[model samples]
Target: MRRPLIGIALVAVMGIVVWQWPGSDAVASAGAPRAAIASQPVANHGNWLATPTADGKLTMVAGGQLVIDAELRRLFDFLLTDSAEKPIRQIKDNARKVLAERLAPGAANVAYTLFERYIAYRDALGNVKPAADATPARLADVVGRRNALRRQFFSEEEANGLFGEEERYDRFTLDRMAIEADVSKSAADKRAALEALENALPPALRQARREPVTHLVEADKAAELRAKGASDEDLFRWRSQEFGAAAASRLGELDREQAAWEARLDRFAAERNRIQADASLSAERKQQAILALQNSQFTTQEQLRLDAALALRARQ
Candidate 1:
């Protein structure tokens, strides 16, 4: 099977996005059954030509409860992409049309109702101000408030189904931060506490958290091997032995891309140093020369990151 070109993002310390929302006690009523055609066609729009990230299945469990999860969120986001550009009424109609096309009538109706409530909740959430402090206490307080607001719109089951995993992960992260920041704890105690926290997580969450760390460790080892004069074939064979042929191929591509990027940066730096060392040029002229050089070397978008890259280079 072909591997994905991009990898899933890994969680980092203080990297979780804080949800800000005001409280609301208005619960959305359950959707009622309505007669619908079996072959309902979606609205003819340019956006629907391609496959969506999520198919908007509106799946239910054996107990006749809706199964809410990240997939549902992805569907909602895909449908609501035009929210900023279009009026709410039109956007909702478009979403309903797509859902009706993809799902059974009863499920589509229920999904539509839930989508509306989600929109209302999100609207209220938009009014909340983000906390300036990134301290664990402040983050936890913000999460608590956001959950309170979420509960007012959804029942216990609904809220849990929709956001349980993310909430759990957030709590775990905050707890980890708190433990790491504790001044009195010895290094050994901190390690034990961190290990305990990791052990407490569900298997899926544990795996998710470990993947990025594993990748970083593997990358460092690969770099060491390369420093010892490992050839491309040697690296490929090593990576393949470790993580299958397909994954090794992808890693090889990544390695080449990184090498090419570094080469470009080196060339840029060499030319830059030469420009700076030219004694005949005035300060203004040198500045203009560097600006011209940057324009010639990088696109407008790439130029945005050039300063930060240069700063990091200087530190190194």
Candidate 2:
């Protein structure tokens, strides 16, 4: 199976050959030439992973310093997925070309150099084996070894920019594990310790870490309110109190979108059923009418999930 890296979804690009899951079959083609990989239209080589343009844009900081951050690593991961089957030289070449096209000449040069080190760092990670006993100390040891490898490969500035957020999260996880393992601490003490650990994180990292859990808790509250016939204003007030006005507005927009989608699905389902039940219409005619209705109602992208939506509705 093709494993998605770091929650990044792989979109199937038209005209590019879909990646075959690496297995015993891939070994048979291990010695295949670089040209064997499908050529993309823009990059001209490798399966190009799409990056979210806002966050993943590559640019330099003021004073000509390279902006060595997680986004750069994201870009590297984007290209590296394409390089999964290619030789090192070809992989570097493809990545270099894409970087040159995306970034300024000077930034591209710096990025290519970092890309080389990143590849080496990833190759080195294959040597990091998990310990037999899954203890907090053992996990911390593994993390330390990885950090050491990163420091060896990258400058302090580069390491900080590239892995700072991740390192902070790791420390938080390890400390939490240690607290959980401490038998002397009462439940309240452990909770206080974990709260302190979260509080110690950088503001942005703390919010990023906490938002999903907060969202789930708020979602349950919102559902309860809606069950009691709460108005949009009421929901917005609650959301604003929980996540601020801007987030509340976005959440309201999302709620409207979901409502609109459910309404459309209902319309489509009713029309489809009517067509199916028409005694005068043949099965072929019913299918054609349903297809036309679908085309008229939903965009190409929305149509992709129509079956699943209908199936889910059926279950509900």
Winner by lDDT = 2
Judge candidate 1 at residue 83 and give its lDDT. Answer: 78
TM for every model, in the order presented, reads 0.65, 0.69
Overall lDDT per candidate, in order of appearance: 0.64, 0.66
* Per-residue lDDT of candidate 2, residues 64-167 (tens digit): 55687766776777677756688889989988998888777888899999999988888776676543344667667766777788899998889887766666
- Positional deviation of residue 3's Cα in model 1 after best superposition, in angstroms: 11
Candidate 2 runs further than 4 Å off: 1-62, 79-81, 84-108, 130-134, 279-289
What's each prediction's clash count?
0, 0
